[model samples]
Target chain A: MGRLTLPDADVIPFGSPGDPDRPGRGLGPSKAARLVGNTGPQPTSPPAAAAPTSRSATDADRPEHSTSHDVITDAEIPFDGESWLEFARRRLMGDYSVDDFGFDPELTDRVLLTLVRPLYRSWFRVETTGLENVPADSGALVVANHSGVIAMDSVMAQVALHDEHPAHRHLRMLGANLVFQTPFMGEVARKAGHTLACHPDAERLLAAGEIVGVWPEGFKGVGKPFGQRYKLQRFGRGGFVSAALRTGAPIIPTAIVGAEEIYPMIGNAKTVARILGLPYFPITPTFPWFGPLGMIPLPSKWLIHFGEPIRTDHFPEGAADDPMVVFNLTDQVREQIQQSLYRLLVKRPSAFG
Target chain B: MGRTVLVTGVSRYLGGRMAALLAADPQISTVIGVDVVAPDSPIAGTDFVRADIRNPVIAKVMGEASVDTVVHMGVIATPKQAGGRSTMKEINVIGTMQLLAACQRTPSVRSLVVKSTAAVYGSGPKDPAKFTEDMEPRHSPSSGWPKDSVEVETYVRGFARRRPDVSVTTLRFANFIGPRVETALTAYFSLPIVPTVLGFDPRLQFIHEDDGLEAIRTAVLSPRQGTFNVAGDGVLLLSQAIRRARRQTIAIPSLIFGTVGRTLSPTGLADFSSEAVRYLTYGRALDTRAMHRTLGFDPMWSTDEAFMSFVRRDSADGEVDVA
Candidate 1:
């Protein structure tokens, strides 16, 4: 059977040569066209005259053609971001439980977590205090200050918990809905043990005797301008406290410092964010100016401090339903995190030291 | 008390097997198998009737036979079996509408079991890991068998509303794979070389043909209210499933996966439709807790066991008559 050829250059232009924004780099049209011509369709492309009708005719003629175990010469397609070995490793570690949340422990530990370990340990030089405050084996809601243009602190905190804590517990983080809606990001987040930051999901994870993490500051803390960098934003609605109250899981107010300096959000592209259906399109000093290179996060000296765990077991039977209790508890946790962040910042010698 | 049961699409393997199985039951006095064409092998203790379910005459047939229960197994899974896309759609959607209309008119029909598919809960990126019976499809299928299944189910719901007394059960079976079953999934897996969407390994679930038949038998014998998700326990990733099938895989980018799939779809190696590729991109699974707790039935085979069984059967024959 003859091989099917890719459409001609005229028909499918992936990236225009003249598009300045695209920079004609990173697996652009030229590479795609070359890959298609050189590496695609191993059996040899059908003759130009036979191109259109070739597929159907070939199909009709040889119905049970056994190409099983044949070497697929067409490997170098677009999205050539990961090496073959890396890709294979990811595949091997992709198994997960039958839960509806789609959390894959193998993928998270071997791929996603490992992918960021270097950044957390060496690049950020992260130091953690009061690690003993985190419960050894049971469910607890770790409430932390959310910062950085991107929420890398949450991931670093996850790494800290997984690597440092004696019990090596996993933190099932509650994330924004936007992350789950996006294509690749959504899948990656789920595999890394993050679920929708709604009450039901949070309560389920907590009740299951798993460590749960929440950054109630959300987009406000992450997308704040550089001038308001270390200042803690108002924690939203006290939903995390309600979840803690309902599950009777202790709330550990965790604080992270030095994250606000990484990719400092100097300006906001509100229009672009709206178009993309994102919370905020942040513009740092290096971004757009340096293109893809701007995405490289600055190596900041990090410090994460865990405060005393607040006992929710003492709350009355239906304290979760009480607005005043939820509100007061939310303020208490927020205040602890805010105070801890200030203390950690004062102790640090320099941002990148 | 004996039942007069009418089963549709008797020409198909599962339909014929189910009809024959039901005839053996002491509770069923008579079983009538109706199809557009005759079955190759005559099923014992059953009467075969040649009739187009799409025709209004189906209502008369249901009335004349005094069928107390109706088993609608007429839904087509693949385009090739039904002659083409348009024909499959007509037989699946229009035929179902006509059959349900017939069931609505027949007051003697106390129970209805509609064979449905898990494809209605499409495999989208944003879909919950496992689909429960209650959740709607993340994205409604645009065309082909999945679309038809959605329509068929909608018609069944409408029929239920009209006949409130009748016990309606919709068993949304996961992709069926076994020695005797012929489906799009089986055809795709039987391919010598399978091409998959690059960088995506979706979880897959399957129910053995034996389990599938037994579920139908259970539904027919002990009719239940509400929908149930019918799949074996556990799931297999697409890559792992291919490895088990002992087939070579070519991973193409999503950009060219469609073009490559379009080229391969007609080749008869795989049923590589746009919908099929979407399944590959985001593999689908169903939560069968309802199938156990609500429907009160457990599949004999797990997802892995079912696929392995199919692989063993295919290897023994080495050639499948895809119809």
Candidate 2:
């Protein structure tokens, strides 16, 4: 080997200074050999070591490649796709776990419970009753009245379960598509362990022995006029009952009061809403025309009451499919929840009562 | 024969109540409540018309109703919602122009009572003496653009000048409080905790909502002309007002407090964006002698009385922890 002497600062190690013809050095021998042919005795120079004080003139001139900056190596691939348990453990210092659907365990519950606590406190003030009726361990399907144009009541219900319940069981919510469409909101929903309330999602969560919540009234229920605040909207085809029957989960009818007063929909801007591609522009004391600043809900006191769970264990497997059975079951649940809310309202003196 | 009066912005907190009060009076035969959003139900015997007063269509409607007086209260009261002086000019200035034009075309229209604000003063001197109707608006060119109050006042004055026969009375109202209040300042001061200065006291003034309604009623019934300062007895310091709020006081530097408040509160900073900040910081004791003398009106509640009433009502309702 010939001695290649250079200045102290200019010294380069062999195979370090990439050959003009060969760019990817030390990536692997095969990649290096492919770049620079193995046929000749290429002069072995010291690695291209630049002085610490010197700026590399060619730093900005690097060639562009097809691969992304965040590409993972083949070795990084786990046996069965990335497990949320492992990812959360490594990323979140094992402080988090994965829910049934691979959501951040600790964060999912934390966000859900935190959002629900204030709502639960508010709910207690308005119409809360039958806290003792909630079973300690069994999976239950909580069907509640939904009102408040934005479905803020659903969030209130989820919060009620997490904060008021002794066991602190995480209630998986079925959110609407509009919620997921809003920016910064969609990610929060998913991480908080809410999924679409479609049959598959309901079945999956219920089958895993997890408490599932469904608002049968959906948009129609929550978006009712201020005049019809406490009135429950029409429940759609008994899909909740079918989900309960399929998973053998008990149906727990729930009612929420005071969510209606938060943002009273005094009027609607139908023309503006249609033009802007929105459901309906609510002319509350604040909203859309007022911007996001308007969305700050009035701190109205709330009340939530959970009724005794109707056991479906004794019913036949396909009992939900029977029209008469579904209709009767749905009516019974709705009437019970409605009556409880009215009684609670009567007992309470005012709107914030 | 009973007279017909047209009131716009009747759906607003102040305007709506004013309409209700006017409609209840037996002297007013027909009260036409005009607004973009009509009330769910008509105000007793009053006729309700869901029409944007800014629109030309209002002239046809008002003419048909045989409106003898036009009480122009349909204004974007909040500076935050008004956008800029141009916006204020558009709705307050031009809206008045259109309504005035409608009134002129309607032969029965003889009077115009405008609900202007003491804001026209734009942070006047804190002297105990009251301002007269002839007193030149204390607004300065250096104080930035005119707010809705000033613009609306100027527009009404110009309209009065052109149409001499049409008796125009501009009521420069001070801070008024009563039931169904929606002002940011009122809500802020009524909160469980009010952010205020320990030593510095800015003068505060208010008229009861009933008093304000009474003033409007007086303006409508009487043959009064020109401008009048519709205010209570005197001014109360910011400290006194905050204390009256009954909420715990968080003493913070005005500048720092305002910065944090503007960030956290929706109405806080945005409300002050207009020259209204000048009035908020500096003391302005408005003179209400003209309102009392001209309209033969006396406010039932003073600043202290109004504040205590608000605190009592709010506390009793448990809407807020006044203590």
Please name the candidate that would achieve the greatest DockQ relative to the true structure: 1
Q: Which ranges in model 1 have alpha carbons more than 4 Å from their true place?
A: A1-102, A175-187, A196-204, A217-219, A233-251, A269-279, A291-293, A307-336, B268-274, B317-323
TM-score top scorer = 1
| TM-score per candidate | 0.77, 0.45
**lDDT, candidate 1, residue A253?**
88
Q: Tens digits of per-residue lDDT for model 1 on B219-238?
A: 99899998998998888877
- lDDT, candidate 2, B6-32, per-residue tens: 998887777877888888888888888
RMSD of 1: 18.1
Model 2 TM-score relative to the real fold = 0.45
**Per-prediction DockQ:** 0.09, 0.01
Model 2 DockQ reads 0.01
Docking tier of model 1: it is incorrect
